[model samples]
Target: MAESTTVDIESQQAELDTYHDEPGDRPVLRARFEHNGSPRYMLYTIKRLGLDHEHGFHLDVQLVSDSLEGGVETVEAKLQEGDADLIDIDYISTARERADGAPIVAIHPYGRTVGGLVTPEDSPIEDLTDLRGRRIGVVRRLDKNWILVRAACRERHGFDPDEEATPVEAGSKVELTRMLRDGEVEGVLQFWPIVPEITETGPYREVLPMAELVQDLSETDRKLPISTFLTSEQYLSENPDAVRGFKGAYRDAVDRLTSDDELWEDIGERLMYEDDPEIVRAVRDGWREMVVADWDAETIDGMDRLFDHLLEVAGADALGVDHVPDDMFRLEV
Candidate 1:
């Protein structure tokens, strides 16, 4: 495949007078990311850092417009075959295990959850047990929400996902939401933001939150890993200052995301621009449930368990704990 046109930090900055910042003093950070349907909040954060043209640091973001599976394969190929300077990927658990020689820098966390229950009046599908015999529409079989939901059903509700519930796969969120509105599915399994968005649009009864089920089955400290950021190991060693600056900027973005309610509303609106106003509100509400943190021991361990479980489900070899580097969760400067 032909390589995309490269954007040089100094040259790009020099072209724009207003964006110009001291280039020599700042380090440049190059990154590539997968376009996972949702407008990524991290990208917004990166933009907010003003590193796009800063002198001491420059940040370049690229969008992988391919299928998620294809994107993953491309990322793995780039890491295994070439000498790329920077890479930022979604769903770090998979990348961390397969990165080979690349050093990874930690970033914010996000996870999957079942849609929030919306009711004309309150109903009994109050917990995982109530899901049996019900129809559930999912965006994709391999999506993280489906995995998390399957785990909850098996571990907590004692229900076999294939046996207990009807599973309908939709190609997009809009299609899935339409199914729910039409009474085609009793529940919808999706990530955080979409659940609330669907509920606000009406026709659905309620969102059966998967996180609450996980909490009930597991401990309060336990949480599932949905996604994270990473770069190559070789890049980190060669550009420690750049890595630090990126981390610092990222953490600042996380703080801003977690603290600002209006920002989330704006994000929801931006992401759900094609949807109805009610849908945007629902999306915002669902997104609010997501918790972002710098990966800690508990989070890392939780991800390890999640990967093991996923491997078991897929009937594949499990990734060893040693596969995750000591610095996998390192967020501190």
Candidate 2:
């Protein structure tokens, strides 16, 4: 594939408008990511520190919005349309898309970035069992978190939330948080960064971190990668060096995120939606462990087992793919 054309980060999205600016001779990897998400913390670090250039590539960061008309497209749409070179998505969603012949591949793991079941502080719902016959808010019924909840409920409590309780699809993450805050739902499964914002600022608390269930179901002591860095097969085959450069930069970014306290403070001030010191600390502490810098054969084995478990519990309809494609994961680059 040809070197991806760089978009002026300042002209693309106003929420987070900055880039490395110095491309030099490195190939450009256009990354379409969600605004104010956890991935931005690393992307920002890469741009701020010029990690991409150091690793022999230029990181051209593009922010995607929930809607397409926001000047930039959604991550999946941008990637599939070939408007962007790469993006990060949950592996399960990547499986579903690839099964539908989207031709995307998971290049590396992004660690266990799944959110937990959060409930209001005063609610009587203590555990997954208590969620029975209650309204639960989610981004969508088919979201990985909701499916995990369903599978865990069935496997652990012998009850399926989908069948026993009403799942209100709030349509988006913002609305999901609002649903829980307004008492529209007894509990909500919101993503990280946002979860800390909700739990730390008000009368909400995490009932369970989904990572525990991921460990229980995968039956691995390791925190396997749920979300992964993805790219098109064309991009990977044509620009192998660019992909390798990205992986190296990503590893460095993860290292910095792990040991850098001052960087978190900078992120809190500039990148975070809620910049409260407590929320910033919560996000930093919770996020550092969720990022997997690298993966190997053993890690792939655990991911395979996790996929089988999801297939067994969530079923094809909920998973959106009957089976994971053979070429879905391409870590070689």
Candidate 3:
């Protein structure tokens, strides 16, 4: 709500974090989240709550890996190997991972998205129907979204992405947009976060809300995939303060972020690839769709629906279990 003068990031973090670089009495919680917007929220929390000079422990978030591709997996491995404390549940909480009987659990409700599919602005395609017999540019990986796209194609049009249409993968969003802008692909299926930038900055149009597409194809009532902080059962037990502190700070950020135009503008100017007003507004609106207050009954229900859809395509063995564990959401010690 108020203006915050830009300061040295390292010093600001140290001043805001209860657990500074110097080891403190408060347990240091080493964590990594998809830097997409998660870190921005955390940083906002530090500023909003004046946590920079607060006394307590620290939640050290490694924001080096900007995308989830490398960061989430690296954190998941570290947590499983006992080198890190927290990571996203999507990384390791698959049915198969749960079936393995590992003690990982969703420690905090971070954010959620229903996502979207976009296409080139000049393309003749107007809706999902046009996607039939066309090539689409996607991310570098066969993410869950891609899996759902395959399902949607098979059910809606009897056209399989693998056989009837081409789904090309590029290294990053920039590369993907490059291909699309250069007329290499007819359409692009991407998530919500980068879609705004794609439409506002690049040559594209946001079409086919992906959550609706996935829901139509999968018949899932609540099409939501939660982005949460997950931790080993042992770690939660060991460092209760770190867990609670991080959660409180995160909630503080989300609670205030939506209405804080100044913060949003500042964040946009600092983080976005381009600093245009339209792009900032679009990105902020996209982030707005991702924020939530709690993992209430409805939220968890949405996760179950999504998990079921994933299970059908990815299978129990591939997902690592036969069911979604109830203990995935833990609010306290």
Q: Could you say which candidate leads in TM-score?
A: 2
List lDDT for all candidates, in order.
Answer: 0.52, 0.82, 0.60
Higher-lDDT candidate of 1 and 2: 2
Look at candidate 3 and give me any clashing residue pairs. Answer: 15-52, 16-51, 16-52, 95-319, 95-320, 95-321, 96-319, 96-320, 96-321, 97-320
lDDT of 3 by residue, 1-333 (tens): 011212323333433353334545667777654334334445545544645325355656553232233423445556677777867645224433545666787866655544567776677888656776788887543444556666566555666566666778764444566677788888776657677767877667887766676456445554344567778888888877777776776666776677787777766655555568887787677666666556666667666776676667545543445687667666554
- Cand. 3 Cα-lDDT: 0.60
Kindly report which residue stretches of model 3 are placed more than 4 angstroms away from their true locations once superposed. Answer: 1-23, 35-39, 51-55, 66-75, 81-83, 89-103, 171-175, 214-225, 309-322
Q: Residue by residue across 1-333, what tens digits does model 1's lDDT show?
A: 112212322222222323334456456665554333332555454564574343245766544432224324344445434434444333534444454444455544544333443433344566666767877777656554565566666665666675677778765555666676777777777545655444554544555666675454344465654555555656667777776676566666656766676766655444343346566555545444554545676776776665555445432321222244455655553
Q: Which RMSD values do the candidates have, in order? A: 7.0, 5.0, 5.7
> Worst ten-residue run, lDDT, model 3?
1-10
Candidate 2, 56-113: lDDT as tens digits = 9988887756433322227888899899998988888888888888889999888798
Of models 1 and 3, which has the larger TM-score? 3
